[model samples]
Target: MKAIIVDDERLARKELASLLASHPEIEIVDEAANPDEAVEKIEKHDPDVVFLDIQMPGKTGFEMLEEMERVPQVIFTTAYDEFALKAFDYNALDYLLKPIQPERLTESLNKVTIKSAKSEGKDQKLSSKDQVFVKDGDKCWFVKLEEVRLFESDGNYIKVYFDKFKPMIHKSLNALDERLDDRHFFRASRKHIINLGWVESIDTWFNGGLLVQLKGGEKIEVSRRQSARFREMMSL
Candidate 1:
C-alpha cells in the first residue's frame, strides 16, 4: 500500500521511515513537515493510508481531515497517549506512540492489509451508468442509478425513488451512501440521499441550512454541518 508520513520533526520522520522500510508491502510515497504540506502531498499522491501526527504546527490532524475532499485511512503517530480515545473516534487504522516499536508497527500494517483485502472483495461504488436490482413484495425492476432521484431511510429499509416506482430495499441509508458515487448521490441529511442531477431548485433554509427541491417535488433540508461541504461539491 502507498503511504505518506507526516511529522514536524525531521528525525522522527526519518526513524519511522527507516522502520517502515523493513516492510515490503508499504511504499513510502512522500513525507511532510506540517499539516499544510501534508495536505498538499496527500492531495497530489492520493495515498492509500497516511501516518499522521496529531499535533502539528498549524492545524491539528483532525482539522486537516475535515477539509479534505477524500480522506484515506489514517494511522496517528504521536507522543501523547491522552489523544488515544479521540483518535479512535475518526475510525483510524491504528494509533502508534512515538518511538514506534517494530511489533506495534507490524500489527498496524496487518490491520491495513486485512482492511484493504475486504474492500477489494466488495463491488465498486454505484455509478450513474450502473443498474441496481430492486424488489418490493412480488414486483421487481432493474433500475438505473441515474433514474433514481432519492433514497429515504424508513426504519431498517431504504425507500428508493424512481420513475413512479418507490421500492423499499433492506439497506440502511449509511450503507447505500458508501456504495453510491458522491458526484451524483449526495447525503443531504440523516434520512435522505438525493441525486444531484435531479435537484431543480435550492433556497436558504432555517439554521444556516439549505433547502433542496428535487424534480419529483420533494423538498429535503441540507443540514448545517453538511451545507459547506455540499456547497463545495456542487460549486454553489
Candidate 2:
C-alpha cells in the first residue's frame, strides 16, 4: 500500500518513515511538512494511507481533511491525551501518540489491511427499491431509496434528505455516488446528487450547463461536463 507521512516536524516525519521501512508492504511515496504540501502530494500520488499529524503550524489535520474532497485511510499521529481526543470524531480510525509504539502501529496496519480486503467485493449499487439505514447522533431511520429527495455533500459528511428530516452521515460524496443507482439519482454537481424523480423543471444555466429545480425546492446546477449527458438521459 502506498503511504505518505505528513508532519510539521522533520524529526517526526523521519522517525515515522524509518519505522515504516520495516513494513515492505507500505511504500513511502512522499513526505510533507505542512498541510498544503500534504494535500498536493495526496492528490498527485493518491496513496492508500496517510500518517497525518493532528497538530500543525497553520492548518490542523482536521482542517486539511475538510479541504480534501476524497480522503484516504488516515492513521493519525497525535500528542493529545485520550480525554481531549474524545471531543472530535476521527471516524473510528486508529490514532497513535507522539511516541508511537511499534506494536501498536502493527496492530493498526493489520486492521487497515483487513478493512481494505473487506471493501473490495462490494460492487453492487443500491437500487431505488432498496431501503437504507441512516443514523445521526441518537436518531435513526430506515428510509426507502425512493423517499429520499436529495443527497448533499457537507464537508466530510453527506446529508440525506427525506420527508421532514435531514440526517448527516460520515461518508464521501463520490463513494456514495458509486453506491447509488444512477437511474434513480443524478449527480447534478460535485456537491449534490438530486433524485431524478423529484426534479420539477430544468432551465439553461451558465456555460452550457443546466439549472434544475426539484420538487423539494432545491436549485441544483449541473456541471457543463454532465449537462449534455443529463439532457440525453432525460430526453425521449
Candidate 3:
C-alpha cells in the first residue's frame, strides 16, 4: 500500500518511516511536516494509508481529515494518550503510541490488510458477521455488525450503539447506510439506522410511525415513511 508519514517532528517521521521500510507491503510515497503539507501530499499521491500525528503547527491531524474530500485509512502516531478515543471514533486503521512498538505496528498493518481484502468488491455490502474497528477516546473495540443495535446521527458524526457502549464514529449515517446490508440493517429514520435482528418488540407510535424496542431496552422510532417497509420486512 502507498503510504505517507505526517508529523511535526522530523525525527518522529523518520523513525516511523524507517520502521515501515521493513514492511514490503507499505511503500513510502512521501512525507509531510504538518497538516497542510500532508493534505497536499495526500491529494497528490492518493496513498492507501497515512501515519499521522495529532498535534501539529497549523491544523491537527483530525482537522486535516475533516478538510479532505476523501480520507484514506489513517494510523495515528502520537505521544499523547488523550486523543486515542477520538482517533478510534474516526474508525482509524490503528493507533500507535510513540515511540511505536514493532509488534503493535505489525498488528495494525495486518488489520489494514484484512480491511483491504474485505472491501475488494466495491458493491458488496458488509455482512452481520463482519467486525468493524471502533475507538472512543482511549477505549477500542472490534465490534461485530450483528451486535450493533443502532446508529444515530449527531451532526457530522454517527453514534454507534452496541452492547453497553455507544461510541461515535466520524462518518455520515447515509454513507454507512449504503455500505450496510439492507437485509440486516434498516434506516428507521433520517437520524437513525437499526439492526433488524435486535428488535425485541414493535408498537404503533405517533404520526403513523412505529416504535421498536431493542433487546438492550433502547426504544427507537421508525419514521412514518419507513413503517410500512419495516413491517413488510419483518413479516413472515
**Candidate topping lDDT:** 3
Candidate 2 structure quality by residue, lDDT tens digits, 169-236: 88889988987889989998899998899889999989999999988888899999999889988991
The lDDT per prediction is 0.80, 0.79, 0.82
Candidate 2 regions with alpha-carbon error over 4 angstroms:
87-90, 113-236
Over 4 Å off, model 3: 36-48, 65-73, 81-94, 101-104, 116-148, 153-159, 167-185, 200-209, 233-236
In model 3, state the lDDT of residue 20.
88
lDDT of 1 by residue, 59-82 (tens): 877667655434567778999886
Model 3: per-residue Cα lDDT over 58-138, one tens digit each? 787767765654456778888987767654654456889999988999998887742344344435677786656665565
- Candidate 2 lDDT (Cα, 0 to 1): 0.79
Please say which candidate is ahead in TM-score: 2 or 3: 3
TM-score of 1: 0.53
Candidate 1: residue pairs that collide: none
Q: Rank by TM-score, highest first.
A: 3, 2, 1
Each candidate: RMSD = 14.8, 10.2, 5.3
- Select the stronger candidate by lDDT from 1 and 2: 1
